[model samples]
Each structure stands twice: as C-alpha cells, then as structure tokens.
Target: MKRTSLIIVSVLVLLSIALTACQPASTKVRVATDATFPPFETVDEATKELTGFDVELMNALAAKAGIEIEWVNIGFDPMLAGLSQCQYDVAIAAITITEDRKKDMLFSEPYINAGQIISVQKSNTEITGPESLAGKKVGAQLGTTGAIEAQKIEGVELKTYDSYDLAFLDLANGQIDAVIADYPTALGFIGQNSEKLTTVGEVFTDESYGIAVCNKNADLLKKINDGLAAIKADGTVQKLEMKWLAGQ
Candidate 1:
C-alpha cells in the first residue's frame, strides 16, 4: 500500500509540472499615454474618450501582436518616468526617440517621423522662427522636445505649460510671442484656430517617434516592433496619416 501511494504521488507531481509548462504566458499589457496632443493623441471632448492617430495605431498593433491592452491616460512627464521605472508595460504618444531617453527606457523601431516647428499669432511678422524668438517669450509643453528646443534659443524667455493648448492660448492672448511644438501637432492647433495661429519658418529638428517600453519588458518591445513592421508594410500607417494628418 505504501509503495502504491508513493507512485501515485510521483505521477501527480509530474502531471502538474507538465501542465504548468504548457500554459501560455499572459499577454495583457498596461499601456500608458498622455492624451493631450492632437492628431497623435487626444481626448474627445464630447465623448470623453481617447482618440487620435496614436490611439488607433496602438489598437491596430495590439491586435496584430495578439496582446490585450488596458489604456492609462497620464501626464506625459509622469508617463515617461513610469516607463523608465518599469511601472507600465508600454507607452505610446508622439514620443520622440533620443539617446538621452534611451538610457532610461527601451524604444521600438521608429514608427513616425516628426519635427519641432514654431507657431505664432497669424498677424505676427516679427517672429519668424527659433532664431527670431531671441529676447521674446516662447511657450512649450513641459518635458517635451519642443521645450528643449525652446531652451536652446539664446535670450529667449521660455515658459513651459502642461499642454500645447495652453501655450497656444497664451500665444493668442499676446501673453507669449510664440510656441514651439511638433509640426503635425502645431498644424492641428493652427487648423482649429486658423484666424489666430499659424506656423512660421519650417520644421527645425528631424525627429523619429517610437513606442516606449519598460527597460525590463523586452518581449513587449519585440511584439511592438513586429506589429509596427507589419502595419508599415501593409499601408496601415499611410492610411492613418491620411485620416488624421492630411487635412491638418
């Protein structure tokens, strides 16, 4: 009887090990985003739902990668910090890839090409671009590449805001001379306030936007890159550009 019991116990242990080994890893990911930038990511005022190019693109990629996602809308700076600390699985905004940032977090392959541009009041002629912003008040969203560029302008008074909308508002109200922001994002703002705002000069810095992943989440990065490659090859990215950026 003792020998028979030992054999049964050994069989159950082996079976348990096999079952555990056969189980698939969890693919549900927590995706963080800052939903304030338009054309890239924004919240719909009427529905209070997140919408924009990044949102749609992320959904497509998640579906292609066979992963489930839960959206977490957070401040852009906080999102970056959280990603570096491995607090979130992934983050997708119009986040420009940089070597300095690369030290903290992992990034997917370049998904979109973006650049910083200068936006000023439509009637303003004195301020032409970053060069002309010298000795002038310039506004940008806090913790963005735009703000970094603004800070580079010698003699320029740099003011950082929580969102581009507020910076543009300050520009419209004559509180600030100009705003530095991503070209497509600036276009979205200018399109809505055509009478009040317009971009000057040209895109200043060449930038590539990438999906941010936590340093510890290498598998997630691979999934994102695979999905991104598929979408780019299938014309999905071009379709999104037309849908959101062409008119703006």
Candidate 2:
C-alpha cells in the first residue's frame, strides 16, 4: 500500500508540472489614452492616478479578457500616432469613429455615442450653432472630430488646442468666441464652470466612440470587442454611465 501511494504522488507531481508547462505566458497589453477628457478619462487630483468611465471600463474589459495592461497617458494626437505604429496594444480615449481614421487602425465596436455641440459664454446669444460661427473664433481640440467639424464651417477662425479644457478656458476669458467639443466632454467642463458657459443649439454631428487597436493586433481587437460585448450585456456599461454621467 505504501509503495502504491508513493507512485500516485509522483504521478500527480509530474502531471501538475506538465499542466503548468502547457499553460501560456500571460499577455500584458499596453494601453494608451489622453487622460485630459473627464467623465470618460481623467487623472484623480487626490490620488494622482487615472480614473473615470473609460478607465474603469477598460479595467473591467482587461479582467474579462484575462490580460494584464500598462496604461500610457499621452497627448491625443501623439496617442494616435503611436497607436498607428503599433507602439501600443490598445487605446481608448473617447476616440470617435470616422472613415478617415478607419484607414489607419482597427477599431472595436463603438462603445459610446457622443455628438459635437457648440458652447459659448452665458451672456452670448449671437451664436446659435454651426451656422452662426462664420468669421468667429472657434476652439477645438487638435486632431479631434470637433476640430474637423469646426473646419467644415467656412470663414471661421479655428483655434486648435491640445486639450478641450484649455479651449474652454480661453472661451471663458473672452479670448475665443465659441468652443466646439463632444457633448459629454463639454458637459464636463460646463458642470465645473456652469456660471460662465452654456451649450447652444443641438448636437450637430452624430458620432460614436470606439476602442482603437493597431491593424496588426487583430487578436487584441477581438478580446476588446468580446469584453465590450460582455460589459454591455452585463449592464456594466450602464452602471458606468450612471456613475460618471448620470446628471450631466
């Protein structure tokens, strides 16, 4: 009996080693984002760590996909450039999906719907929407859909900023006449400075936000889409919306 027990223990140990050897190494994906956009992605002032809707959603997706991630907070345009070069495994920064962008990188299924809107000083009534912006100074974040929309309006003096917060600041200081930005992002700014700014007119352009992956990383793309689908089906997306954008 003792000899039989010893043989069984040896077999079990070898089987455990074989199983461990068969398992693949964990995948660690590098993710990029511009943390300046709030409610979607932002750095916590108190903890100095990244926080917000996109950050939380990505964390959930990473867990679901069984991958480790390294977050890279970078400028919006730089992030795009890096993503195109396959320098990062994934990016999620409230990036809007467009045909032009689709040419350069792979995009996961859109996760959020955000449209462009015009914002002006509280006392200003002259500017109503895109039509009223002719010959006016309009600010938009560089390399964003808002910038593209602002450029479509002929005769407008377009001022591009690295981030929307700066553009909104300039608007508040009377340096710019209007700011064209994603509706929820504009709402994030307006929520903080409600006394100084308000959005005018309806959302002019319909846009959807998506997670970006380099064309070479189809496997990662699948994981992201799969995780996104899971989150959507499990009500995680709705819960995030309620947490970050409920009253905005």
Candidate 3:
C-alpha cells in the first residue's frame, strides 16, 4: 500500500510539471520614456494621460504587431541606461539616432524627421540667426541635441532646462533671449503662444528620431521595424506627420 501511494504521488508531480511547461509566455512589452517633451511625448494636464505623436505611433505599432505594452515614465537622461539594464523593453521620446548611442543600444529605423531650430520673442528684432544669439542668454532641453547646439554658440549663456516648456516659459518671461529645440516641439510651444514667440533661424541641424530597443531583445527590434515599415508603406506615417506637424 505504501509503494502504491508513492507511485501515485510521482505521477501527480509529473503531470504538474507538464502542465506548467505547456503554459504560454507573456506577450506584454514594457515601454519607457521621458514624457515631458511635446508633440512627441507629453501629458495632458486635464486628463493626465500620455498623448502625442510618439505615443500615438507606438500604439499603432503595437496594434499592428498584435502585442500589448505598458508605458512607463522615466527621465530623459536615464532612458538609454534603463533599456540596457532591462528596466524597459522599449524606449521612445524623441530619441535622436547618434553613433554614440548606437554603440550601447539598438535603435529602430528613423521614424520621425526632426531637426533643431531657434525660437525667440517676436519683438526681438536684433537677432536674426544663430550668430545673433552669441553672448546672449539661450535655453535648451537638457541632454538634447538642442542643448549641444546651444553649447556650441560662442560666448552664449546656455541654460539647460529639463524640458522645452520650461525653457519656453523663461523666454516668454524675459529670462532668456532665445530657445534652441527641435522644430516640431518648438512649433508646439509657438502655437500656444503664437503672438509671443516665433521661429527665427532656419533648421540648424538635421536629426532623425528613432525608437530604442535593447540589444538583448533583437526579436523585438525586428518586430518594431516590421511594424514601422508597414505603417510607412500604408501612408499612416504621412497622416501622422500632417496631424502633428502641419501647423509647424
């Protein structure tokens, strides 16, 4: 009777193992980003929901790939590190594709054609271009190409803000002479205060925004690329560009 009971227990354990092995894997992808940027990623103050070009495009991509994702808010500077550390499976917040960043993380193909531009008060007639801002106060988003461009201005007082909104506020409040930021983002701010601000210099630098995916998860990279290609081929990309960047 003891031997019979032992045999029954072994069979039950084997069955449990088989059942566990047959369970499907989780399909949820965790996406992280710094949501402070606008026209690309920003929180709606009234509804407190993340909404913008990047958010919309990401949602579309996920739907096309038949996967679900949870968006996690993170700081801009730490986004790349977060992906490398496995804290997030995907990162997208106006992340410009650069050789330095490409060394550490795998980035998706260019999704957004973005470039840096300058914004100054409408009444500021003395400044016409990048050279005019020399030796004056300029604000830009921290850790961004805008900030990098601002730093290159000889003898300029560069104030790096955490977001372009704050930088624009300072410009509106007379704290700075001009702001350097991406054209689309700067345009969003100008739209809010069209009378107060206007873009002066032509696009200063050429940069393309890309989605960051971890090198460890190469499969995810392929999935995003495939989805992005489908969207671009289907004219969805043009529609999104018109929606977010038409006025800019």
User: Candidate 3 overall Cα lDDT vs. reference?
Assistant: 0.87
lDDT score, candidate 1, position 212: 93
Off by over 4 Å in 1: 1-21
Per-residue lDDT value at 123 in model 1: 89
Compared with the true structure, model 3 gives a TM-score of: 0.88
Question: lDDT by residue for model 2 over 3-116, one digit each (tens)?
Answer: 999999999999999999999988899999999998889999999999999999999988888879999999999999999999998999999999988999999999999999
What TM-score goes with each of the models? 0.91, 0.93, 0.88
Candidate 2 structure, TM-score to reference: 0.93
At residue 186, candidate 3 shows an lDDT of 90
Q: What's model 2's lDDT at 127?
A: 99
lDDT of each: 0.91, 0.94, 0.87
* Over 4 Å off, model 2: 1-18
User: Which run of 10 residues does model 1 get worst, by summed lDDT?
Assistant: 127-136
How many residue pairs clash (N, CA or C atoms closer than 3 angstroms) in each of the candidate models, in the order given?
Answer: 0, 0, 0
Model 3: residues >4 Å from true position, as ranges?
1-26
Per-residue lDDT of candidate 1, residues 12-127 (tens digit):
99999999999996599999999988988999999999999999999998888888999999999999999899889899989999999999999999988999999999889998
